[model samples]
Target: MPSMRTRPSRIVLIALLVVAALVLVAVVAVSAPILLHRSAGGSGQEIPASAVPETTARGADGRVRTLSAHDGDGPADLGAVAPGETLRIDGSGFDAGIGIYVAVCAIPASSEEKPGPCLGGIPEGAESGTVDESRLTSAWVTNDWAWRSFATHQYSDASEGSFSVTLTMPEPASTGLDCRETRCAIATRADHTAGSDRVQDMLLPAVYE
Candidate 1:
């Protein structure tokens, strides 16, 4: 017959072993997803540089400007901008201080429906970058379910937040893909906050390049 004290020791040892096993399992469970995600091309990819069509934006005063791309230097190019479509933006030299919403619409000049403005709900994974005025880069993406990759590196700045310029979407994207009427926007607030505005600019998928 084993003493009760001896049995207690055995029980404790078994508990410890169980806990150790669980710890190992937990480590594997957590790390496995991250490892697999990265291997699956999580986000970073070798995007080649190509000739992107740029829409030269002229302000009401006739000042010439270039609409930024959502992802810069991606394989896809920015071609023509159409009406009622949203131009996603990415750039440096712009304020990203956005609080709650950022959504808008830009209708084509040939359409009868007036372009309506809307608020963009905050993006799912919101992050922040530098506020230096020297840096100039970032990209814009569509909120459509297709996960369509739109303009890349269309706007940016080192200051982290500054919306000095606005861009409009063109009719025909450089990719020649028929674009939809709606577009999404992401901008840096004057104080480096995040915000979205109604802009015009079109982006094509990198795969098409």
Candidate 2:
């Protein structure tokens, strides 16, 4: 009987198998990051379908304002929201195509000489300005407040329809925050469909106010 020996063909086959395995491992490694990025999209946190993100602030006058809004409608009357309730808004604006930006903030005291984009607190050591409704001069004090604290519900399509947004505010276990006089500002960065980049803003004063 002839003694069995390793064949050249068998050796080459083994090398090919090793190379194939390495290729598969490399493919998996390369796709992992992309897979993670897609999965981690959208602020990397899970919120309820109707949940609206909000920011809180206290005015010098002792009133509290909680700000939030959706894609199209002006900011909802957050003061009217019950602890477990959802606020639905209906409206139209220039940003009907892209969506609306909503911000809820306490308008600083008139004495503070606060400015536009008063939706959030002014940043520390930042440029403080003023929003003159008379002259139409608006100033957004950076570093003092938080704007866009939550993304607007971006489901508004063309044809201009109504959109709903929900925010889960903390329970007012003894009139925690005087949502009275709280104002909601909804701004839309309009799409230049017609001519101008007309941004529209609507302020919904608190129900009590």
Candidate 3:
């Protein structure tokens, strides 16, 4: 019973509404994963500065990075850790813009040496169960666009450059490093994106039993 001219206007209004709804749906689809990822992990408590055996390193850029660990409900002694136990490592004062890898590695023989041949290699995803070996290592590189888009577990605070990851201590033999003969450590370094950069390199020495 409407005039022809009014019918066209009504159709146009309905079409606009439909377009708006589609746009909203698209936005949510893109944002939901990111939101969920950022919320997935527990934000661990800050390690006290006075904690014994805490390790600190200063990058060339002068950022003082600190690494510490917690075992079960107690603070872990960085100098001693049992193999195959879960340890929560907390790091701060890193350059969030630079990606980093945290793993158990051989303590480099010299300050100029890069830590590596680490346990668990590199993890493929941020979410648990997504990567079979993520239990032994973690990567935090929200600065990398591809990682940000695909990784479902946000392990680091992009703004503060701090991260908390729980790593299951691997057997010394599995790390390709002789922990009993050579020193081993929970170490961090620039991730593959900036593979040659060592400014983020730091280590918390640990001996496995």
Tell me how many clashing residue pairs each candidate has. Answer: 73, 7, 0
Error of 3 at 32 (Å): 29
Position 193, candidate 1: lDDT: 17
Order the candidates by TM-score, highest first — what do you get? 3, 2, 1
The reply for model 3, stretches above 4 Å from the true place, is 1-52, 124-129, 132-134, 137-141, 149-155
TM per model? 0.25, 0.29, 0.65
Of the candidates shown, which would achieve the greatest TM-score relative to the real structure?
A: 3
Instruction: Give the CA lDDT, 0 to 100, for residue 55 in model 1.
Output: 30
lDDT of 2 by residue, 153-178 (tens): 33343333334343333232223234
- Model 2 TM-score relative to the real fold: 0.29
Residue pairs with backbone atoms closer than 3 Å in model 2 (clashes): 52-166, 67-104, 121-144, 121-145, 122-144, 123-143, 123-144
Per-candidate Cα lDDT values, in order, are 0.30, 0.32, 0.65
Per lDDT, the best of the predicted structures is 3
